[model samples]
Target: MAESCSEAGLAPPPELARLAEGLTDQARLDGVVGLRPGRGGRRAAVLILIEVGLDGPAILFLKRSRQLRHHAGQIAFPGGGVDPTDVDLVAAALREAEEETGLDRSGVTVLGVSPAAHVAVSGFDVSAVVGWWHAPSPVAAVDPREVETVRMIPVAELTEPRNRARVRHPSGYTGPAFRIDDWLIWGLTAHFVDGILELGGWARPWDESRTVEIPERYLTDRRDTSGDVNAH
Candidate 1:
């Protein structure tokens, strides 16, 4: 018999611990968390802070400012490319999160990291680092230079079959997105959402027909966080 998905709780497994530990060691040498492109290319790292609560953990995602170039108003983790001045991948992640959403990093316990993701839009190979933030947020200020808004989706919602779907963008990319109530979490943010769910062993077989429809304005601005919290 196959293992039931619900058997896995909202905590990371030993595999996750091993991966996270390895990243720290590797970062000591290269001092970076990034994806290696096919050949000569640029790679960046993004931090997906998963705030675990009594109800489990909630994944933190953000909406980029509409005025930006590349992937504006698209949902993503609180991160950007690696800075040469940074000490390592973890530093880069914390720095970006501070710059993007001003979420205090002192309380975060990093569980581990998912595999590096390659993005064609920004031509970046990105490493999504997972951490647990234990503090009251509604967070702080978001830097106007990058992010515009921030949202948190409960981890349990990602495993719900009713919340998952393939978001087809006009850019010719049909990819993952989750609807939890009102937020349409697609693009890079969506990918990490699924991966984190799998890591927690909470991946449910969601019905594709039950996809949460994205509001027209979801593609343009910050989420309202009202009404139904759609899942993906």
Candidate 2:
């Protein structure tokens, strides 16, 4: 397959292009959390795949399969715990993307990585690798056991007041949330998405006063399951 940006008519979005032009390594170190300096927790990596769509630039997300033991039925980036054979975080992210979304790694341009964020629930430190899909590929749920559906959420739709809200956790933690159709994206996924939008300077002012509760069912079920202590 001819995997080239020109062949696919794909180009980086304006905001991303600007960031890439002015981007410094220090940008990844800013505003990151749970920075466990040592290496005790499991290592994991996720790809933040951005592409220029008809409406504009959008990000790719996945709805995890409900049948999974951990973080079931949750919205997450396509990633998992890094295997011993994985060379680095970027390789792990790309491998997981290919496994979960059928995304061709060759079609993606490595933009860099964000600081390591700890997922306390899974006891894993995840590094999010930001990438531009210069040569787009057909993305779908390659594994029914891991992925439920694939979504390319437009940046504009996410920043809209009607779709934005704050999700309150039972633990009294509050963070950004987005309502995309029937799916409610909250937790770590929402936090990462919110940060990325701001970093790209593509975020718009929305009513932050709007609030919603993270579904009790999700919280309760996760507590009962042995998957992980926290919902990633």
Worst 10 residues of 2 by lDDT: 221-230
Over 1-232, each residue of candidate 1 has an lDDT whose tens digit, in order, gives: 1011133233443434443444445443132213222222354567877665667667787776667644456566777677898766667777878777877776566655545565554456566766756444556436765667787778677777677887765444555778766556776667666655654556788666544444454443332221111111
Candidate 1 lDDT (Cα, 0 to 1): 0.58
Off by over 4 Å in 1: 1-40, 135-138, 170-172, 209-232
lDDT per prediction? 0.58, 0.73
Candidate achieving the largest lDDT: 2
The true-structure Cα RMSD of candidate 2 reads 4.0
In model 2, the runs with Cα more than 4 Å from the true position are 1-13, 21-28, 32-40, 221-230
Consecutive 10-residue window with the lowest summed lDDT within model 1: 223-232
Q: Write the per-residue lDDT of candidate 2 for residues 29-96, one digit (tens) a residue.
A: 45644323314677777888988877888889998888886667788888766788888888888888
TM-score of each: 0.69, 0.85
